[model samples]
Target: MTTDPQTLTWFKSSYSGNGGSCVEWAPMQATVTGIVPVRDSKAPNGPVLSVPSRSFAEFIAGVKGGAFSAT
Candidate 1:
């Protein structure tokens, strides 16, 4: 499935703070669909990752839970 590219309002994670990690996502878009689109904040026209709604939720949970830094 696809969406109107011009209408997407993407925002970077609040956790990103002042760093240049540059990750962006459209939460409003995900609310309208069952998928979440994520991409580089610096590359609006670049590749995007479309993840299922549930998976996106889990990803956020993991981030909040600090799963990525436990390795």
Candidate 2:
């Protein structure tokens, strides 16, 4: 499904804690389409990164599991 990114509502995680470096995602769009739209919260009109739902879920899991740790 195709959608205008501008029309979709975007939101950041509460864990973001007011940091300007947070990333935002459109959950409604993700629900409608299998694609997850991600973008920098600092730039609302900036380019969006479209990730497959399964891949996105895996990435989130990895984050929760600390797979992407800087250490």
Best by lDDT: 2
Clashes (backbone N, CA, C under 3 Å), per candidate, total 0, 0
Candidate lDDT scores, in order, read 0.83, 0.88
lDDT of 2 at 34: 85
TM-scores, each model vs. reference: 0.83, 0.89
The lDDT of model 1 is 0.83
Cα misplacement distance, residue 67 of candidate 1 (Å): 1.1
The C-alpha local distance difference test score for the whole of candidate 2 amounts to 0.88
What digit string (tens of lDDT, one per residue) describes model 2 on residues 1-71? Answer: 36777998998988898758799999888888889999998888889999999999999999989999677
Kindly report which residue pairs in candidate 1 clash with one another.
none
- Please write out the lDDT profile of model 1 over residues 1-71, one tens digit for every residue: 39864578989866787667788888888899988988887778887888998999998899889889856
Error of 2 at 38 (Å): 0.4
Best TM-score among the predictions, by candidate number = 2
Q: Give candidate 1 regions above 4 Å deviation.
A: none
